[model samples]
Structure formats: C-alpha cells, structure tokens
Target chain A: MHSIDFIVLFGTLLAIALYGTWKTRKSHDLKGYLLGDNSMKWGTIGLSVMATQASAITFLSTPGQAYQDGMGFVQFYFGMPIAMIILSAVVVPLYFKLKVYTAYEFLEQRFDLKSRALAAFLFLVSRGLAAGITIYAPAIILTAILNWDINITILIIGVLVIIYTVSGGTKAVAETQKQQMVVIMAGMFVAFVVLLVKLPDHIGFKESLVVAGKMGKMNVIDWKFDPTNRYNIWSGLTAALFLFLAYFGTDQSQVQRYLSGKSIKEIRLGLLFNGVFKIPMQFSILLIGVLVFIFYQFTMPPIFFNKTETDKLATSKYEQQYNELSKQHQQVFDQKRVLLGELVAADKAGDEESTTQLTERVNKLQEQQESIKAEAVGLMQDINPDLDSKDSDYVFITFVMKYLPHGIIGLLMAVIFSAAMSSTSSELNALGSTTVIDFYKRMVNDSATDAHYLFMSRLFTVFWGILALLFAVFATQLDNLIQAVNILGSVFYGPILGIFIVAFGVKYVKANAVFVATVISEGIIVWLYFLSRAGKLGITYLWFNPIGALLVVAIAVVLQAVWPKKTT
Target chain B: MLKNDSFMDFLKTPEYTEAPVLGNWKAFYLTSIIFFVVELLLFSYLTIAY
Candidate 1:
C-alpha cells in the first residue's frame, strides 16, 4: 500500500475510535456502560446491529464465496426477515417490559439462576470464539496480501477495538459502529463500481451479467428439497429461521445492540430495518464477486489467488511441475476466451442454438482448467500440509491490491479493519456485560454499588479482548474462518435458543427441568455434529439449531411432568 | 356489537402499542411481512430472468 492508503486507513479508523471515546467519556454507571443509558434511536441501533453482524469476514469472505460458489448463498438469509419479525413481535416487548440489562436477565426472571447461567455460558463460549474469528479473518487475508505479520495484524485490530470498548463500553461500540458501517458500505460500493469500470470495453454490464448467468453464477434460488443441501430455499427458511432467531433474539452481542434503544418501538424499527436491508446488502456483495468472476473471463486471473503459498511452491522443488500446469491453464484460458467472444456475438445476434453449444463447450473447458488447478493445489499440499490451499477467500483482496487506485486501496483496507473492529468491539462489550451482569453481579456481589459494577464491566471488556486476541492467534489452524464462526454458533445457538424458547413459550416447564434438558440437548447436539463430521450422519449443521431447540422444549416438558420439583 | 367490541379489545391488548411510523403494532408487522414477500418475489424473478 502507498502512503496515501496508510494515511486514509489509519486516519479514518482513529478518528472513529477517538470520536466514540470522547462522546461517551462520562458514562460511569452500569446502565450506561452496558446499555448505553438506554437512549439510542432506531437509526443508530439499526446501523450498529448491521455493523456488528457484518464483521470483517462478511466483507472479505462473502465475495470470495460468490466468486467460487455462485449467488445461491443469498438464500441462506431468506429466514432473516422472518426471524426479525418474530423477534420484534414477541421478544422485543418482553425485554422492554422486564427492563433487563441483558437477555439472560429475562431468562433468570422467567426460569431460574441455573437456566440463565447456562444460556449465558453457551453465548460466552460461542461468541467468544467467534470474536477471535472476526479478528483472524481479516488478519489472515491482510497478512497474505500485504506480507504483514499475522500476529501483528491480530494485535493491531484487537488492541484498537479494546481501547474504545473498554473506555466507553456499549455506547462506544454502538456509536463507532455507525461510522464503521458507513465506511464499510462505501468501500464495497466503490469496489463494485471499479470492477465494472475495469471490465473490458467489449463487455458492458448487461453482457457481463449474461456471461456470468450462462456460467451458472446467477443461480440465486434453489427450490429442490434436500435436507443436506446447505443453501436451498427449504433450509434457508427452516433451519436458518431457527438459527437467525437464536442469533438476533438470544445472542447477547445482537440483543445488546437493540436493548440500548430508547424504547420497544425504536428497537423493533431497528430490527425490522435490518431485516429489510440485510438481504439486498448481502446480494450486492455477492453480485460484486460474480462481476469479478465475469471480469476474469476477459482478463486472465492468477492460477491460485493465494500468492504467498503459490510463491512458496514456485521456490520449492515443484517449480517445474507448477510451470507445466500453468502453461496448460493458459491454453485452456485462451480457448475459453475465443469461445467467449463467439458466444457473446452469438448472444447479441439472438442465435439461441450457437449460444447453447458455445456455453456447454466453454463450461467443459472451465472444468478442464479446474482439474489442473486442483492438481497444483494437491502438489502444494504435498509440499506443506499445514498451508491453507483454499484460495477463494483471497480472490477479492488480490483483485483490490493489484487493480484499485492507491487511495481507494487504503480506503478498502480501512473498510476491512473497520468491519473487524466494529464486530470485535461489540463482542467484547457483550462478553463483559454478560460476565458482569449474569455471573459477577448476580452471584459474587449482588449488593455492589453502580461504580463498582461499572469498574468491573470495563475490566471484563479488557479481559475478554485479551482472550479474543489469544484465540485469534490460534485460529490460523482452522480452515475457512467464516464457516468456522458460523459452525461454532450453530453448535451452541440451538440449545441456548431452546432455553429461551422454553422460558417464553413453555410456561409449565420449570427451571430445573429445562436446565437438565438443556445440558442433555447440548450434549446430543455436539455428538450429532461430530457424527456428521465423521460421515456417520447425513444431517447438516443448520438443522442443529432447530433440532437442538425442539429437543430441549420436548424433553423439558416431559421432565417437568415426571421429575420432582425442587425449591431453590 | 358485543363481538365487535371484544375484537377491538383484542386488538388493544396491553402488550400492543404504537409503532414508530405505522399506525399500530399489527400494521407494522403486516408491513414487514409484505416487505418479506416482495423480496422473495424479486429474488425469484432474478433467478428466472437471468
């Protein structure tokens, strides 16, 4: 990156952080620290909620996902709007009525201390691990593209978030996130426009989209019923419904975002706004990736997008073999380009038969190219078993670094860092609040002053920030950081949402029964997940949320009927 | 007349309150659901037309 990029990146990030800290400097009580004095409007709350969930991975990995897989991933969010409506209609008013600082606080009031503690514990484990991933996702890509040390990248992001979050708490996170969301969206829109502008003169936007559609990148909706298919409409509506319910309704990081709103109306508006806008936002990001895929058709892309690993292979004993594979890939590309020109001509001339024939031929050539690419990846894996050979995550950043202007490159980098910081800050804030409110204040010092609680809140924020940084360092061992975060959430969110479901709907099921049910259900979910991983089961992870939740409710009801009630 | 009054009472349940923009909670919910339907249709159209 040039000096211009550095200036823009650091200047934008530091200004947001400093502004948040300054704005919330006097928030010295527990309420202000944890819930932003319960004064945020819908607009701020909505943007904050979006920013918290977007994360660095959403910006970095999602485009790569589209570049590789296609637009079917957008279906995964079909359930989000439904989830938001349910939360607004059912969950928001309940929380407001309870005047709760955390979602778990309502659980304790409805169920018992053990139930609340269990739900909070699940959230802590899942979101804590996910916070590390939010930092690690950007760090790994930046390290690969910029040649920066991964550890330093992790440290820079972790420490920068902790400063404002520890200083000003929830208000700080929410306030800064408003600005971060602006930067993130602006950068993405700029990238999209630049990709269009950078396309070959022969290919206009509509023609490029036609090319992409012909190549199967525009398959946005799949209606076929398959339980194991991850992104089909059924799974998106069913399993994803339960997952989003758990995430937006029970996850402390998100719950805390809206809880800081001025009233139930404000919170509902904020959530509904998210529900309305989130799908289109994700579609846009994925569309940019598809556009990039089309752009690469006219211009040759790298054999492997991850240059660091490819460079390593080049200097090793496999250099000759790699060069041979590269030569073959170029031949395929040349053939495909010639076919593409004819296909574009055929398409423009409204010649349907030739278009179909050319499309099939081009697809065959593309498959041939993929096989050679796979062989090269296999060879690289043989040389270094530990290297991450999956290059989809590197596609967008590689394009950015090589193509975008200097100032905009820095702005895009800032977009990534802003996303990372926005998410990590919220996670730290929620972790600190849950630790202080659900465990420390409730159990350790029930009679502590507001001053004491506020101090503990800041201290816990710092503590969790440090813990997340450590986890980020360890996260390099994982494959595909975005999937890692989601899978972690899916594993734990089921039982936690089940606990809340019981508390909300199954009024007859007492605390002891639900608590026992939650423990057993979580154990079963973990075992089932392992079975699926080991190829012993055919279930997908998305199913885990609904299955885990329903198991708790059903088991809790049975246990409530059979087991003896115990006085607390 | 009695049934109509009871139906209105159900609509005026204490948990229900004024929405920020829409007239009431039910209206707000209806609007959100409508938005959801519109989005689904738009996506389906994109899938078919492309």
Candidate 2:
C-alpha cells in the first residue's frame, strides 16, 4: 500500500479507538462499565448491534463467497428479521424489566443457578472462539497486504481491541462501533461504486447483471427442502431462524448491545433497525462480490488468488507444473472473455438463440477454468500439506489492492480493521460481563464491592482478549473462516437457545429437568456434527439450532414427567 | 432507572402504547416485514431474470 493508504488505515482505526476511549473514560462502576450507563439512543444501539454482527469476515470473505457460490448465501439471513422482531417484542422487555447485566442472569431467575451457568458457559465457549476468528479475519488481510507474519497481525488487532475494551468496557465498544459502522458502510459503498465503474465501458450495470446471471452467480434463493443444502430457503427459515433467536435472544454479545439502550422502546427500535437494514446490507456486500467476479471476467484473475501460497509454489520444484496450469487458466479466461462479450451483446439485443448458445460456451469455459484452478490448488497442497488451499477469501482484498485508487484502498483497509475492532471489542465486552456477572460474581464472590467488581470486569476483558488472541494465533486449520465461525455458533447456540425456550415457553419443566436436558441436547448436537462431518448424517449445520433447542424442550418435558418434584 | 418488575409483570406491561419514533410498534413491525417481502421479491426477480 502507498503512504496515503497507511495514513487512511491507521488514521481511521486509531481515531475511532481514541474517540471511544475518551468518550467513555469516566466509566468506573459496574453498571457504567457493563451496561454503558443505560444511556444509548436507538440509533447508537442499532449501529452497534449491526457493527458487532457484521465483523471483518463479513466485509472480507462474503464477496468471495458470492464470487464462488453465488448470492444464495443471502438466504442464510432470511430468519434474522423474524428473530429480531421476536426479540424486540418478547426478549428485550424481559431483560429490561429484570434489569439484568447479562442474558444468563435471566436464566437464573427462570430456572436455577446451574442452568444460568450452563448457558453462560455455552456462550463463553462459542463467542470466545468467534472472537478469535473476528481477530483472525482481519489478520488475514494485513498478512496478505504487508506480507507480515499472521501471528503478528493477530497480535496487532488483539492488542488494539483489548486496550479500548478493557479501558472503557461496553460504553467504549458501543461508541466506537457507531463510528466504525459509518466507516465500514461508507468504504463498502465506495468500493461498490468503484466496481461498477471498473467494469468494461461497454457493459452497463443491467447488462453486467445479465452476464452474472447467465453465469449462475445471481442465484439468490432455492426452495429445496433438503437438509443437506446449507443455504436453501427451508434451512434458512428454520435452522437459521433458531440460530438468530439464540444469537439475539441469548448470546450476550447481541443481547448486551440492545440492553444498553435508554429504554425498552430504544432497545426494540434498535433491534427493528437491524432487522430492516441487515439483509439489504448483506445483499449489497454480496453484490459487490458479484461485481468483482464480473470485473475479473474482462480482466484475468490469478490462477489462484492466494499469492502467499502461489509465490512459494512459483519458486518450488512444482514451478513448472504451476506454470502449465497458469497457461491453461489463461487460455480458459481468454475463451470465456470472448464468449462473455458475445453473451452480453446477444442478451442486450434480446436474441434468445445466440444468448443461450454463448452462455453455454461460457459455462463450459468456466468449468475448464475451475478444473485448472483445482490442479493448481492441489499442487500447493502437495507443496505444503498444512496450507489452506481455498483462495476465495483472498478475492476481495486482492481486487482492492490491485484495482482501487490509493486513498480508497486505505479507507477499505480501515473499514476492515474497523470491523475487526468493532466485533472484537463487543465480544470481549460481552465476555467480560458474562464472566463476571454470571460466573465470577455469582460463583466466586457475590458480596464484592462495586469498585472490586468494576476491576474484575476490566480484568476479565483483558483475560478473554488474551484468550481470543491465543486461539486466533493457533486457529489456522479452519475452513472458510466465515462458515467456521457460524458452525461453531450453531453447534452451541441450539442448546443455549433451547434452555431459554424452555425457561420462557415450557414453564412446567423445572431447573433440574432443563439442566439434564441441556446436557443431553448438547451431547446429541455434538454427535450429530461429528456424524455429518464423517458423511453419516446429511443434515446441514444450521439445522442444529432448532434440533438442539427442540431436543432440550422435549427431553426436559419427559424428564419433568418422570422425576419427582422436590420443594426447595 | 432499574425496573424491578417480575417476568410476569413485564408481560403485563404494555410494550407498545406507541413507538418512540414510528407511529406504533405494529406499524414498525409491519414496515419491517414489508421491507423483507420486497427484498425477497426483488431477489426472486433477479434469480428468474438472470
């Protein structure tokens, strides 16, 4: 990156962090530190909630996902609006009425201490791992751009997040996230416009869409009911619905965002804002990926987008084989580009016959390109067995660096780092709150002074931040960082949501029954995940949310019937 | 500013006499749902048209 890029990147990040710390520097008590003094307006709460969920990975990898798989991935969020509405209507009021610091505190009131601890433990495990990935996602960007070691990048992001989060707590996380979201949305909009301009002069936007559609990248929905299909409308509505319910209703990271609002009205409005805007925001991000895909159709993308791996192979013994693959890839792109030009012309002229024929040839060439790219990936794998051969994650940043102007490049980098910090701070804030309020405060010292508890809150933030950093440093074996984070959440969110579902809806099932059911449900979820991993189960990961929640409710009901009730 | 209402009391407390910004909670909810439907239709059109 040029000097302008560094200035934009560091200037944006440090400015937001310092602003957050300065704004919330006076927070000294548990309520102020953990709940932001309950003074945030709906807009701040809404933006913070959005920023926390749309982490660096969303900005970085989602476009690549769209480029590779198509826009059907947007289906994964179909359940979010419904989840948000439910949370706003049902969950937020409960938290507001109870005046709870963490979502798990509500579990204790409804069930028992053990149940609360179980849910909190589940959250800490899932979100702690996700915090690592949030850090790791932006680290990938810096590592690629600066050719720096991935560990150092992870440390840089982790340390920056820990500083503000541990200093100002939830207030800092929320305040900075508002600015970060603005930067993120602005940068993404700029990039999208740039992509449209970068397209071939002859291809107007509608024609570009037609080309992308003909190439199968415009697929936004599938009505298939197959459980194995990850992003179909059915799994999205059911499994993804359960996932969102669990995430927004039970996960402290999201719950904490809305809970900081000035009132229930503010909280509901904040959630409603996210529900209304989130899908559109996601669609636009994915569309940017589709635009990037179209841009590369006219201009040749690398045989593999991951330069770090490709550069190694370029000098290794496999260099000759890699060179052959590159030639084949270039040949396919050459043929495909010509066909795409014809396809666009035919599509523009409304000549169905030629459009169909050209589209068929273009798809055939795309298949050839994929095969050649696969061989190159195989060569990289052979060269270094530990390498991640998936190059889609590198697609967007590669485009930004090679194509975007210098100032915008820095803004985009800042956009990514801003996302990383926004999410990591929220996670660490939530983690610290949960660790203290639910576990440390309840289990260790229930009578600690406010000053002592405040210290513990900051201490726990640093602790979780370090833990997340360590996990990110070692988390190199995951597949498609975005999917890995979601899968991790899905595996645990189900049981936690189930515990809450029972606590809210299944009142007859007491704490003991729910607690036992939670354990069994978690075990079943893990077994199901392993079975699916081993090719024995065909269920998609999203389905785990509803399955686990339902299992807990069902088992708790059965156990409640059999177990004798004892008066406490 | 902490409300000490029980969960049952919370249920009894009317949540939406009116929304803070929008006309009413029902209107806001309906608007969000309508937005969702419009997005779905737009995406569906893209899918079929493409």
TM-score of chain B of 1: 0.53
What value of lDDT does candidate 1 attain over all alpha carbons?
Answer: 0.87
Please give, for residues A285-308, the per-residue lDDT of candidate 1 as tens digits: 999999989888878988899998
Worst lDDT 10-window in candidate 1 chain A: A476-485
Best-fitting candidate, scored by lDDT: 1
- With a 3 Å backbone cut-off (N, CA, C), the pairs that clash in candidate 2 are none
Clashes of each: 0, 0
lDDT of 2 by residue, A362-438 (tens): 99999999999889889899988977878788899999999999999999988888888888899999999999999
CAPRI docking class of candidate 1: incorrect
The worst-scoring run of ten residues by lDDT in candidate 2 chain A lies at A477-486
Query: Model-by-model lDDT, in order?
Result: 0.87, 0.87
DockQ of every candidate structure: 0.22, 0.39
Cα RMSD of predicted structure 2: 2.8
Misplaced by over 4 Å in model 2 are A476-488, A564-568, B1-23
